[model samples]
Target chain A: MEFKRLNIVYGHYGTGKTNFTLNCASALAKRGERVTVVDLDIVNPYFRSSDYHEELKRLGIRLIAPISANTTLESPALPADVYSAFSEESGTVFFDVGGDDAGAYALGRYSEQILKSESWQALFVVNKFRSLIALPGDAVSLMREIEAASHVPVTGIVNNSHVAEFTTPEDVLAGYAYAKEVGAFAGLPLAATAVPARFADSLQDKIENIMPVEVLVNLPWNAGK
Target chain B: MSERVLMKGNEALAEAAIRNGCRHFFGYPITPQTELAAYMSKRMPKIGGTYLQAESEIAAANMVLGAASAGVRAMTSSSSPGISLKTEAISYMCGSDLPCLIVNVQRGGPGLGGIQASQADYWQATKAPGHGDLHILVFAPCSVQEMVDLVGKAFALADQYRMPAMILADGMLGQMMEPVVLCEPGEVQMVEKPWAVTGHGGRRPHNIVNSLFLTPDELERTVKERFERYRKIEKTEALAENYMTDDADYVIVSYGACARIAKSAVLAAREKGVKVGLVRPLTLWPFPKQDLIKAAEHAKEFLCVEMSMGQMVDDVRLAISCSRPVSFFGHTGGIIPTPAEILAEIEKMAGGNA
Candidate 1:
């Protein structure tokens, strides 16, 4: 029942939030480290922390969710078990919060308690194609909106910039720069930059403040009949 | 050597498919199932495989069919609405007698259902997915380890029967994490697909893998042949897990995510000194008829816990063949019945019978 620093990953829809969290959890759990993922996003049907249950289990990481954590409640509220897990002193815990500003607001209600209870880092994930953030300035404004709604300081940034199968290394680098500027504007660290697996080597030289892609890129391959 | 590790059902499924030689995955983003596609996306490319997030569920399933025709293991996944969109391709694959994996990590359904876990797709998955008398080998994994194991079995059965195979799992199974043993690749005998579209040379005639049989006679023949394969599968592939049923007075029948919740119910019932047991069907298509009938003989009553409005209950009742009174309790459109809720239903049912 030990707790490590709480890592919070959040973003807009299709920003690779769930996938990123899964890979991060996998990397930690593979090393015999105890971790937990809270599936805070009940809104998105596809990309939630719960999807990696089997992988997490394999890695000995406990997953706590509203439904799995508790059997009652009509809406099945996000139980406080995850926060409790984070408050513990040794294990790492990650929260895969929901997409959209509304989803962000859901986290805002509990942000003060989470921030107070644990040494937490909230990374606002940004995919350049998502939201109106084509440039660094636009990203800062959006970050402010997210921060305002969540009422928690956006502690870091992860550049999950990809345009489906068309994402290039250039797009990924631009995401890095965007994260840098956003970090400067928000007085936070640029935690990571999600480069596609194919472009990992190409961006090695270009990336300054970067977190290499732990997960592979999803490209459109011809799945034949 | 297979390595034992913890994995979520969806992640394990992705890994299992890779182990089963599924080299291609086509899917769109959806909750409760994104892990399967995401895991594949991350690993497939590194291992000389293909992973694509298609424009829509329709596109994803068709891409799976395309890969399947090449006689390689291929898969696509989605939640409720997305699964609905992909049914067109599922039916086509059925008609064509193609081998592939169609995973429906079911969420709330009807239309744009909520992201919560659900099991409403029992009928859609077990029944002929498309037009005609087609059959898909439907395997329901209860845990993350089972997810990996079943994906391998799904591929084997699909290839063995020359039909589409489906892991008719729900969001809970897809999203929940559990410890798993990752079966190493190169251990299992990769099924040699001789009828693949690697490329046609002048040495042999070009191969066309399609479901469009122009003549009625040919279509009928295809259906009849497919039925024969299904019958063979029905005989060989039915699997179920029975828990503490040897001295139980009542049995609960369920599958996929529902079965896990039902397991908790059985445990609670036993704790309260009620003689209850569980029969979890691992294969939905074959339906574990013999096992249900066998368990029904000793049990006083059978309760079916499902996430649907009693879809699997029908199959459970059908399987028992009137060995006992069969009852059902469920919540539809992605509403999950809690272990306590299911136990309450069980208590009510058992009381009336007692």
Candidate 2:
């Protein structure tokens, strides 16, 4: 892939956006790029990027999360340090935006700085097996909703489809077709196809732009390999 | 083979209730459990069902009481503080002998505690769901799939027994995603509510659904009659799962989300040549006393693990008649104990440290 100075990831909740964001941040850090992950996901109290604060720090990725990320605030709370993402000049920054339009409303706060920099790409993650956004039309409409709420135009779509830990190769292949449909409907380019790292080798011959990700941000029972 | 789809516990509970013929859902959004209501709000309208977000938790519980009196399946969900507001309605439901599903996706509590998962409501659920001398059928499911399975059973048993049923879940199960094959209960054959307050159509005497008994004698009679049904339920409805307890020296007793952590710890202990097992309670109200008595015969020690500061330990002792040396290990105030911590506790118990 390509390295934009900043990358914004937004999608419907449970669409594997956080997992994809973590994968991207880890990959960027491994490639020796200074990476800072701003977790703007106040919509979901759990399973967000903030839950992996220690893990992210161990990977040399700085995280800017909500004030109530690891606390019991009973509401979504964001920190004021989000402005630093715009000021930092050397490393790649990734904003793990919230889920859906309701979640993306948080991203609207920093949309001005992101626009002024002119070095960012807002990617909408799409999943084929999710219940509410299973259809290509539903996915595009949600993308439109996020764009309208965040005031940041989504430039590309990331096809990160799976049934949680139950993802099969068949689901990833089918997701490529689904992502293409969503891209056509919304006139956005398919930027990447996210596959769990275990399935990356078998799918390399058949799939393109494969972003193999380690499954983090999960429960102990079904914590995938 | 049943094809499974990934679903959060809260979503699975909402979908399972819908499949079991629940048409009315009254809810006030609260954290962790809010997704269940969100799911209901999204799906209820599409199915021509009633999804009303009441003004407060009190209003939501009353709405369920009203819908349940009209002989329809109704449900309401909330966390700890919210569940506290609904307790009055729960007592009234018990007094009126009305059956409705009440889901408590619990968070830390005492008064408006934190939003993370906690089993602090065990006593509130099993001992006194309401003020009167009544017992609500309570189920504690440990997995997302079990959450789906028990929602149907909870609704069915509630209707059968003519009392409120609660799914005592916590934030961990509600937020975690897992693959669950939702039971497609096609064409739900609803149980007939002959004593319901449905319009009579002038064919027969109108049914009265009331909890008000003016005279003390009449109230006592009602209490005694409810106790008789409770006795039968206690005898027949207790459910527990015994994991590798056949020849074990130490047994861990847990329920709900804590049980999963306990099971993992038990496995680790067993791998180290320490004889250990887990006895998980599926029903909290019935308490599954017989299973504990059976385990007490072989296991020399028992450990009660919970998310709260050892709330379920007393029940374990009462179940086993204080036969074995029972130890309690837990964390309260929204802290979940890790498997290693629990395993360390097991090791201490194994070394006869208490």
Candidate 3:
């Protein structure tokens, strides 16, 4: 449950990986711990953690993204600043990676330095509600592909499943069961199950190792609320 | 009515497809619209349906063509650029008179656009889905519940007309989560496809499904007949929703996700006694022209709001026939116009400082 020096979060699209990573970085910074989030998501243009640069900066958390992230240009060029994340001496660095194997390939380029680094955890985030990995077998297979592409072993599984704003306590618990099966099949430990802060208390008795999260990302259509 | 469950718009549309007896789904993965394919991949196997992740959008669309030709309910979906790739096969379906559903969870476009919400494909969906003088039925849904309802309707309309029908949604509608009441299991009334290619068996003449006509006269006759059907649909199937248009001076014309924001602005303007209202087009192709003409009776001017750079404005102008001055306001490439921004425009249209 304690913070790792380098935390790499990976998952399929719409698995709430970016939201989870943003919340994780914010929590660490709030705890008086130095934090930096490397926006390794070159695949997606919208809803990346880098889109929240101003908000993250106000929270004293650094975000280093690709050169053209959140821009009109679909550039695949990774920034050289990502190299500094691995070399940082005293802060907890989180790699908010892009969704599937294609996104994980970017992390493969840094495999040499990551292998020689100190304590780190490559966490595979799973949301059972998302397609492709709804089944335990599918989630395990996707984890294998992510590991193969990144050249980093997935040390843990993080159950961060919810159906956007319509998520219920039951949905979170159901995702916990699904994530547990995925962890068992992949032989990975369950790091934590995330629930929205509002429903955390209601779900406490049903699940263990709960990480309460606040939804940070919002599309333009959802601006009024 | 079924119990309401919170669902993503994409997942809800997939489940609705299943409920309506759509057993064959062919798709290629693209952002904003991938969840629908993912949902089908999981549920289709359990229900004895075919869920294939095709090699490309072109292949997937052709697969839909094959499945639909065999008398099965079939569909394919993609985002903006992916939809562009599928246009060729869609045109083939239109010419062959194949009934199928095509879902376009539109994103910012013109090229390999951003995977954000946009309504920039209105012209593409309404005017030119493919080459040739063809028109397919296009439905626009504003909410997750509407997505579920409209997908079933899209399949039915496709079959009834024996032409491709589209559910035109933006990335925002596809990705957003909201409570929705999925149709009760087995509630849908299935359409019978007697004209399908199931083999002759010496019982009847052999049926051929194709878009090709080597002779120019044959192709011209086919095109003319299809337009006849489109004309009937234009008269009977054009759908729109009027909000606060009963007694208004200025009417705002919008659709899809942008209409939601425009409705909010309309309500805010009403609170300030601006006398503004909204006319939301539900069918983009058969395009509620008569309803706009009706709204034009009381309205002094029309303001078109969209996620694109005024794509729908031309249609609004055509509908009103330049009887009143038509103004435009929007943002392109996924920058959604806010309700406040829309209200400012409404204020400006009403002769007030923006």
Candidate 4:
């Protein structure tokens, strides 16, 4: 699958959507493609892309976030720089939307511009391990809710399931099957299956559209690792 | 018996609450604790229970008070700042003598602190959950399985004592994943609340659930009676787990997630021929003072290790009555100390004795 000009990643909490977006942006930047990641997540204060401003800058990727994105202040202040993501003529842009319907509403503000954009894909990320959307039917309902709140229909499904650091290739394969069921229920195509970089080599042959992921977002408790 | 499954600490606590007949859960979303509320939101409706996301932590705690007054198992959970918001309702519950469970997956605090694992709320949870001479039963769990087991125990204690009980956990225990053997919903025995205000039906006198005692003398008598019950709880319900303390010369006092790191340090210190043991407090309120005094009998000195900067050390000193020297080692603001660092501290304490 060709990378679109604009990619919007949406998922339930703990589905690893932020990690997926970061890895995707890092890969595009490494390939000499201009990449800008917009942090549209205001619901979850922790583990957002805005916390990685220094890292993202070093990786040659631009990170546009809310006014006080990673600060202690609970401000809903969306920055004016977010408009740059839509106006940029070059570079791949990624939107890390928040986890729930409330978070997706932020994207609805720019829905008209997103709809008129030349090339864009709103990918619904699914992780079967999360308690909220463990079932295929629940995943479909969540996708519909995100679409309704964002005012942008989901273009594809990305199977990015894992049990945190304990994920194995078998877990990824099982999640791929679960994601396929969710894709069928949502009437969306299976865009990619994100595997941990360690397991990418052995599972690449079996899984199509493999998006090898490097875990970048570390929780404070897991800081030592 | 249900099979063991790998689950996050927050999810396990929620499932255990459900198994313990907790049909009502009211909470506002906060980091490190959002998973517990999310799990309750998903599972409560399926079991014909009430799962409400109140507008604020105060509202959620008040909702728990309402549910508990109706004679049902009710719970509310939040992180540090949110827990602070629920204190007013907690005080009300304590004054009214209502039974309810309050889970605090503590994070760095004082004000709007960082969202990370922390034990800084120890003093707040055990000493002063709310204003007045109020005491709430507090249980601290170190592991995911302990989170499940203690949640069931927390509800039981709440019902048995007819007071608010807190499951004092940190973000590390709330977010980590481990194997847990969940109790079957029907298997666990639940305590019945005979004092519940479930309508008199004209057959009995009307029971009113209120904390207001306008007369100062009447309020004093009620508070004194409550303190008598608290005294009995402190005497009978204090719990602690002692590891390798029999022949050790030094003892380390820790609880919650810090104990997990302390235990590893104890084992490593033992391997290096250091006589160190650990006293892990299971209940913080009815703090196992007697057990610590007994441990101090064999040990020369004590060290209190925590994720905060020496909050629980005062309790350790009070437990031992200043008979032995007490030391403290911790990292404040959500920085967890490594086992190696704790082991080095143990070696230093041991070297001082030599």
TM-score of each: 0.66, 0.96, 0.85, 0.82
Order candidates by DockQ, high to low: 2, 3, 4, 1
Which candidate leads in TM-score?
2
TM-score of chain A of 1: 0.79
lDDT of 1 by residue, B136-179 (tens): 78888877678888888888878877888888888767765454
Q: Residues B1-354, candidate 2: write the lDDT tens digits.
A: 345666778888999899889999999999889999999999999999999999999999999999999999999999989999999999999999999999999888789788888999999999988797889999999998899889888998999999999999999899887777766668456898999998999998999888999999999999899999999999999999999999989999999888888888888888888899899999999899999999999999999999888889999998888988898999886687888888899999889532
Over B27-46, each residue of candidate 3 has an lDDT whose tens digit, in order, gives: 99998898799889988999
Over A135-194, each residue of candidate 1 has an lDDT whose tens digit, in order, gives: 667667766776677777777788777655566787777667767777787787777777
- Regarding DockQ, does 1 or 3 come out ahead? 3
User: Model 4 over residues A1-225: C-alpha lDDT tens digits?
Assistant: 457999999987668888899999999999988999999998766667897898899998989998877555667778887888987654899999998888999999989988999999999999877755778999888888888999999999999888776788888898999999999888889999999888798997898999999879864333333
lDDT of 3 at B123: 88
Each prediction's total of clashing residue pairs, residues at least 3 apart in sequence or on different chains, is: 39, 0, 0, 0
Error (Å) of candidate 1 at residue B290 is 0.4
lDDT (Cα, 0-100) at A27 in candidate 1? 69
Per-residue error for B271 in candidate 4, Å, reads 9.0
For each candidate in turn, give its C-alpha RMSD to the true structure in angstroms.
13.5, 2.0, 3.8, 4.3
Where model 3 places Cα greater than 4 Å from the true spot, the runs are: A131-134, A177-189, A199-208, B1-67, B78-92, B107-117, B131-133, B143-145, B171-188, B210-228, B247-249, B267-275, B320-323
**lDDT (CA) per prediction:** 0.74, 0.88, 0.88, 0.88
TM-score of 4: 0.82
DockQ of 1: 0.04
Q: Write the per-residue lDDT of candidate 2 for residues A1-225, one digit (tens) a residue.
A: 565898999888777888999999999888888999998988778888988999899998999988877876746767778888887653799998887788899899888888888688989998887767878998888889899999999999899888876889998998899999999999989999999899798999987789998888766533221
